[model samples]
Target chain A: MCGALNPDELTLLSRHTRQIEHPSGEELVGESTRVEAYDNLMRGVVKLSKTLEDGRQQIVGLQFAPDLVGRLYAGESPMTAEAASDVEVCRVPRATLERLIERNPALRKRLMDQSLRELDEARDWMVTLGRKTAAEKVASLLLLIASHLDPEAAGERRIFDLPMSRLDMADYLGLTIETVSRQFSRLKKDGIITITANRHIEVLSLAKLQARCG
Target chain B: MCGALNPDELTLLSRHTRQIEHPSGEELVGESTRVEAYDNLMRGVVKLSKTLEDGRQQIVGLQFAPDLVGRLYAGESPMTAEAASDVEVCRVPRATLERLIERNPALRKRLMDQSLRELDEARDWMVTLGRKTAAEKVASLLLLIASHLDPEAAGERRIFDLPMSRLDMADYLGLTIETVSRQFSRLKKDGIITITANRHIEVLSLAKLQARCG
Candidate 1:
């Protein structure tokens, strides 16, 4: 959306926008609170999650660089947005962004495009959460993280750092931490991935990982 | 979006739009096919689903009246869209709708708003599918259907028809037909809902139903 803005619009945006950084594990937006700003993530990752009444948490979605971080035109945030890693975002006041969207068709279209893409991705994740097995769930999460962390090397053998912890991964995949760990060990035993450290993962065989995702 | 359109834009839409009715079981869009037209559901219900390589199907979403049926600006549909019941939709060529969106900011914002709302709903459903039990899942589906079918009577005691069959409900809820049937019977026995027939459901106690949707 920012790419399509004209000089005047860019100037207007700069007037209201501020760059803010958050450390890992910081809550960026609280659930059910009024949305005060529209954030454009410029660096690092964030997780959108909801907590059940009994305290069970589920990571509903993840946002990467260039993704919008808050709901626009809505009164309150539906889920909590947490910094999965050290994060930087361009924060624009909700009212200012709404006014800008009203005046700029290009920006509005860009936002619509982003929302549609997010909706598609969310639905795809629903399939994994609802139907995929525990091992497949772990593989799906790994595949998702790999594609997001290194888009250019999606189908190729590569090594990457995990932005979130194993507990977060287990929550996102809707499995127990032990189950997730077991799956990771099984994958390692089968030579699909190598755990360099707790957070670093080496993809030994992308083909095998993809097959396990099924 | 349609409600905010100007007279000239409405005329332009009317010029190219065609209304079509589909039977209960017709597929509106196949998974991964190029989207040729943008559809607005005028009546009845639609289900968006994805199928796995092993032939397991999971319904990711349900669309009601005035909801957009296909994605805009995307090349291919991510999931298969099928009519959950007798449906009516206003179909416009994809190119035509794209051009109109470019010309109208309100329409773009409306679509963006819709997409964001759908994303929120999808995330909420993810929590249900991932963590909720079988009886809770059935209760959740019933509550969802009742609210959509009659929004004004959501919290009040009311009755509404189920748009889809037991199999469709099972697919959407990520449970077997037997489990879904057993849950329905349990709900009836518990006096949370009264089964008028196989497809008809009378929500006798909205509070009890909500409690069951733990």
Candidate 2:
């Protein structure tokens, strides 16, 4: 969610934020915990997930650096949030953040714009959940990862880091780990993407990947 | 999405509202058209929907009396909003509402609460989209309609009104119209819910409906 933040607005928001860091695999917010603070990520990734009664885990949303987390002024959180990598965040107390937003019209506008964008992303995920095939889902997930790594690299052949494990990717995409692995293997077999041992992926054929995504 | 509103907040929100009547089958916002204003239903119902390139329609969400429409400050709507019945709405300019929210912290909090609730609902819908069977989908949709009709009548057996057509229900459940009809027939045949001539439904057995919903 890009914001049209002038320097003045940016400075105002920054004034209210405090820097905080968490090591990889640390729980940022636990399920049923009172959401006292909200953070805008300065660096690294987090996964927002929920577990079912049968212990099946589902990855609901992912927060990249610069994305917001820990629901602003929400009463309670239904899911758990954890840092998937070494994470740096700028945290603001719920009341302070609310006060700032209420005072600054531009900040409020930016927040509303971000909320709308998140809503659109959720709706798009609905399409994937409802109709897309496993291969298409894998392709879409890769496309998301590639764009996040470098938005300009979306149309180019470039190496990108895969932030999450195959298990996390499987949960996020509503597929089994085996299915995710199989799809990645199929992509490599078709000369669409090259995977490195260190979890780096190179897009060999962006158009072909897009075709598989549909 | 219903909320408890104090008299002052309710009056302030209702102050600039103008009620307009819309018959069934009226489109409040269409695809590709820029959304100019947000609306709140004063009476009746509205359905939010989107259509695929192949003409497959999906009802993304529904709005009841006292529910807000359009993205709060967004100028263009991603989904079409249509009158599911002879509906009445209080339309307000986006700028005015934004200003009102900026000035009133309570109002802003209420709006954020609503958005978060809607987000949670969307996530629950994701579970259905990703996992539930067609029968479960239809059952879930019917229960949602039933609850909206009367929030307090959860345990009691009761009949409720259907604001939309079979086709609309079908779209919302991501099933064929025939499939929806068949599901209703099966439910009625099995004594779970009874359907009357004007699209009215009576859940004869709540337990049976709940069982089918899973």
Candidate 3:
């Protein structure tokens, strides 16, 4: 988010942020609560989700390293945020950031750019959730993770650890755990993706995977 | 979005806008096109959607009066915007707004606020798409429209025209037209809502409708 700022401004903003570490599965922010701080991820991942009153949950977005992790100007967060893995973050006080945003147009623009990008992502995922078949949904999730790790890569092989557990994947995809498992097996059998040790994944042909994501 | 500007600034911004009217079924913005301008809704509703390569489509969002209609900074639009009803919009050159956003902090803040709000709404809809039942989805759509028409209303009767056709509702709810029709009939039979002329609806009990949203 400091990409738009000069070195002096970047230094000024960093001085106000305090470093914090959270273990996997820690609740960093609660649903419907007043936001006190903005956490900028320096390592690992965080999952953002909302739960209905009946306990039905959906993972709406995921944050990776170097991403800012808070809703700005909304006063209260509409979703709960959990540390999806052991993570390090720089916690900036909400007031401090708000003041900076008010005074610095570059800082505000950078944050706005992030917000716009996130909005685009959320809308794309809506299409996936609303219209995609179960198999396509799984492939889309993999494609998202791989693309994030390497934005310009296509038709290339990729090997990485699935950042989310099967249960979390189910929540993210809006599918049952059994369906998620079945899709994984099907993908493996189809020579699209290979699995090892449950969470490890290797995309044999990203082009093939993308074709299936319709 | 001119809400945050002073009178002089508002006039300055208004001077750059041209009024345009689109009848129902007009395409305000095409998907995957280079967006040269932003349309500020001065009149009616616009449905925003994305279609897959093989013809599958999903309506990602709806825009009402006083809403700005276009993606900013993301050079190419990720979705299409179509007029859901007869609409009037003030068209402003995209570059003009870009310049204003760069120079005016309040204008930047206003637009940022809208983006953040849209992000929250999108995430909430993700839960609906992924987890909500057909019945709940139907109820949620009604509740959204009713609540938008009157945010503080509950337990009271509301009479309004359905903004979109049954086909559009089906697309928005991620259900088939038959399923959407059945849900409407079920709601009417249950006395939760009453329909006349197909497009006119009377929500008999908003509290019941809210409860049914799940």
Candidate 2: fnat, from 0 to 1? 0.23
Write down the C-alpha DockQ for each prediction: 0.74, 0.35, 0.88
Q: Chain A TM-score for model 3, please?
A: 0.93
Give the range of the ten consecutive residues with the poorest summed lDDT in model 1 chain A: A147-156
RMSD of each: 1.8, 4.4, 1.8
Q: Decide which is better by DockQ, 1 or 2.
A: 1
Q: Which window of ten consecutive residues has the lowest lDDT sum in model 2 chain B? A: B1-10
Task: For candidate 2, write residues B1-214 as lDDT tens digits.
Answer: 1244466656776676566788888898887678777787778888887775656677777777677777776567777899988888878767767667666666676777667667777776766666566898888888887888866885748688887788887777767789888888889899888778958888888888878866
Model 3: per-residue Cα lDDT at residue A124: 95
**What do the candidate models score in CA lDDT, each in turn?**
0.87, 0.77, 0.89
| Candidate 3 per-residue lDDT over residues A1-214, each given as its tens digit | 6666678777888889888999999999999999999998899999999999999999999988778898986678899999999999989999888887777776776788888888999999988998999999999999888877657655579888888899999999999999999999999999998899998889999889999999
Q: Residues B13-91, candidate 3, lDDT per residue (tens digit)?
A: 8889899999999999999999999998988899999888888888989988778899998789999999999999989
Q: Find the 10 residues in a row with the least total lDDT in model 2 chain A.
A: A1-10
Error of 1 at A13 (Å): 2.7
True contacts kept of each: 0.62, 0.23, 0.87
Indicate which candidate wins on lDDT: 3
Model 2 residue B130 distance off true place after TM-score fit, in angstroms: 1.7
Per DockQ, what order, best first? 3, 1, 2
Q: Please give the lDDT score at residue A186 for candidate 3.
A: 95
